[model samples]
Target: MARQVISPGWKVVIGSGIGISFGAAPIFTSGFALLTSAMAHEYGWNQTEVAQAATIVLSATMIAYLFCAWPLDRLGSRRFAATSIALFAISLVVLSQVGPSLSQFYLAAALFGFVGAGTNVVSYAKAISRWFDRKRGLALGLAASAQAGGSFIVPLAAHGIITRYGWSAALLSFAAFEIVVCLPLVAWLVKDSPPADASVPDSGSRPQIAEPEVAEADIGAAEIVRSATFWKLALCFAAIGMSFYAIAPNTMYILTRRGDVTAADVAWIQAIGAIAALFGRILVGLLLDRLHARVVGILTVLLMATSMLINGTATGVATMAAASILMGFAIGGEADLMPYLAGRYFGTRSVSKVFSWLLFAFCIGAAAGPVAFVRLSTLSDSVVTPLLLLSALQIVPVALFLSLGRYRTAPEPAFNLAAAPS
Candidate 1:
C-alpha cells in the first residue's frame, strides 16, 4: 500500500484561504451594513454619509494596489501578507474607537484600505499562480471562496455582537481574531513558491502537475495599460464590483425599505447568499477548468443581472431569498474569474502588477457603487430605480467578456483524477 502525498501548493492554498477569510475585502464588505446602521443611528448620519466610509476604503485601496504591486512582486507573498494583516488589525482597533465625528470614521476606513490592501486576493493569487497551473482555477476558487466564507460568518457573528454589545465590540472581536489567529497561520503556511525539492511528486504516490511554460511575450505595465484587452477587462470588472458592492452591502437597507422585512430576516437572507457564493466559486472553478472563461463569465453576469431585476421587483422575503441565491452564485463566479482571467491573459511574469491595475479598476467601481446607489435612492425615493440601473450596467461586462478573445498564454494540459495513484 502507498501513502497519499499532498502537494505543498495545497499548504499555500490552505494558508491563503485562512488569510483571505479574515482579509479586508471580506471584513469590510460583509460588515458594511451593520457598521453603517450603527454609525447612522448613533451619529444621526444619513445612508449616503455612512456609505462614504465604503467609498473611502475603496479609494484608499485603489491607491494602495497601484503602489504595492512592485513591492509585492519583490518581497514575496508571506512577508507582505503578515505585515498587512497586522496593520489591518490595528485599523480595526482604530475603527472601534471612533467617536461621533464622521471624519474619524473616514480616517479609519482609509487606514484599513491602505494598509490592508495586501490581504486582498492579489497577494494570495500571485503565490497560488506560481504554485499551480493545471488546477489554477480550482485552486483559486477554493482560496477565493474563503472571502465568501468570511462573508457568511461575519454577518451572523457581527450582528449578534452588535445586537448585544454594539458595533464597537464587533470590530474589536474581529481585530483580535486577525492578530490571534490569522497572522500566525499566514506566516507559517503562505509561500511565494514551492520548495525546490517538492517540485517533483513522489513517483510511488501521486505525480505532480508542473507549472506550464508560457510562450507569450511578457507585457510590461506600460504596454498592458495601453492594450484594448486590459481596458475591456478593467471596464468589465468595474461594473461587477459596482453592482455587487452596491447591493451586497446595502441588502439590509434595501429589504427593510419595503416595511415588511426585519433585520433578522435580512441577515438570514445574506447568509443564504453567502452559502450560495461558497458553492458558486467552486462550481465556476470546475467550469473554468473545462470550459472557456468568457462563456462562463458572460453567463454568470447574466445570472447576476437577473438577480438584480428580481431583487428590485421583489415584494416578499421569499422573492428576495430567491434573488439572493442567484446574486450569490454570480458573485462567487466573479470572485474566481478575476484572478483566473488576469493570470490567463497576462501570464504570471508580472501578474501582481497587472492584477493590481485590474483590481484598482474594481476599487473605483466598489468605491462609487454604494454612494451612487444611495444618491439614486434619494432622488427616486425608491430602491427600484437604482437596482434596475445596476441590472442594466451588467451589460457592459457581458459585452466586454464576449470580446476578450482567447487566452494569451496556453493552458496546461488538463489533469485526470481517474488516473491518479491510489
Candidate 2:
C-alpha cells in the first residue's frame, strides 16, 4: 500500500487534531511543577511534598493504564478515548478547587490518572493505527505528533495562564480544551474497526482501508512475540522511555533549582521543543515507511545522547534552549515511531493492550528517572554532573536496540477472535 497523505481518514485526522492540542491538558508536567509554587505561596508546602504530589499524579496515571488497558481494545478506540478525556477534564476541575488538604491533592491526582492515561503519548497512535492500514507508520506518527504539537502550544498557554490568572484559572482553561476540543473530536472521527467490518454502524459505507504493499501475514501479536521482533521493539522503547522520562518528569524543577529558571522561561523553552517535535514527528513518520524502522530508533537514541550531554554542561539560557530543541526532536521522532512500528509489525492485533503493557515500562522509568536525578542531586547538591552522566547511560539502550536489529523478523496479520459484530 502507498503512504496516505496526512489528510485522509477521520480517525487519523481527528485523533491527530485532538493529539496536537494535548500539550495544554490539565495536570501537565508544567502545571504539576507550578503547583509547587502555588502550594508554597498559598499554604507553605515544602519541595518534597510538592514532588510527592507529582509522583502521585504519575502513579495514578500508571495505575489507570492497568485498570483500563484491556477494555481499551475491546471497547474500541473512540469510546475508550473519549470517555477518558472527559474524565481528565473533570479531574482537572476538581484539582483546581483544592481546600487546604494534601488528601485533596491525592484524590484529584487519582481521578486525573484514571481519565488521562489512555489519552497519552501512545494510545493516540494506536487509535490511528486501528483505522488506517496503508501508510500506518506515517499515519500513526502524524497523529502522535499531536503530543509534541500539544507540548509546543500548551506550555505557552500554561505559562500565560499561570503567570496571569493563577494556576487555578490555568487548570480551568485546559479543562475547557479537553471537554470542548478533544472529547468532541474523538466522538466524530474514530470507529471500532476497519471500515469493512460489518459491526461498524453508521460508518457511511466506507470500504476497508486499502491493504498496502506489505502483507499482514506475520504481523499479528502472536506471530510478533514468536519472532524476535516483539522483544526488540519492547527493548528499544523501554530504553527510549528511560531516556526521555529522565528529562521530562522533573524538567521544570531541575531547571528552576539548578539553572535558576522561572516557570515562564521553562514554558518558553518547552514550547520551542514542541515546535521542533512538530517537524520531527511529521518527518520521522514519513521516513519510517520509506526506510528501516531500526534507523529511526538508532537516530533517536543518538540525538537523545547529544541532547542530554548539551544539557549537562550548559549554564546559560542559550545552551538550555538548544538542549530543549534537540531533546524535542528525539522525543518527536519516537513519538511517531512507537505506534507506527507496532502497528506495522504487529498488525494492530491487541495493540491497545500490548501497547499499554509496553508503555508500563515508561511508567517504571518515569518513576525512576526523576527520583534518580533528585537523589543524585541531593547527594551532590545538584543534578548537573548526574545529568551529564546519564547522557552516557543512554548508550546502553542504543546497544540493546542494535541487538534488536539482529533479531528482527517479519510479522503476520491478526484478526479479532472474540468480538461479536454490533
* Top candidate (lDDT): 1
Q: CA lDDT of each candidate?
A: 0.84, 0.65
Q: Please give the TM-score that candidate 1 achieves against the real structure.
A: 0.93
Candidate 2 per-residue C-alpha lDDT over 142-256 given as tens digits, one digit per residue, 9 for 90 to 100 = 6666676677766677667877888788788888988888788777766545544322111223444333323334345465467676676666666666566656757776677
* Cα error of candidate 1 at position 27, Å: 1.4
lDDT of candidate 1 over 1-422, digit per residue (tens): 55436657888988999999889977776777877788789889887778888888889998898987888878888999998999999999999999989889899989988998988788888888877776788889999888889988988888899999998999999999999999999999898876544552212234444444244466777888888888999998898989988886677779898549977787778878888888898899889888889999998999999999998889899999899889888988876888888888888776787788888898889889888888899899999999999999888999899998789765664554445578
Clash totals for all candidate models: 0, 13
TM-score of every model versus the real structure: 0.93, 0.84
* Number of the top-ranking candidate, with TM-score as the measure: 1
After TM-score superposition, the amount by which residue 353's alpha carbon in candidate 2 deviates from its true location, in angstroms, is 2.2
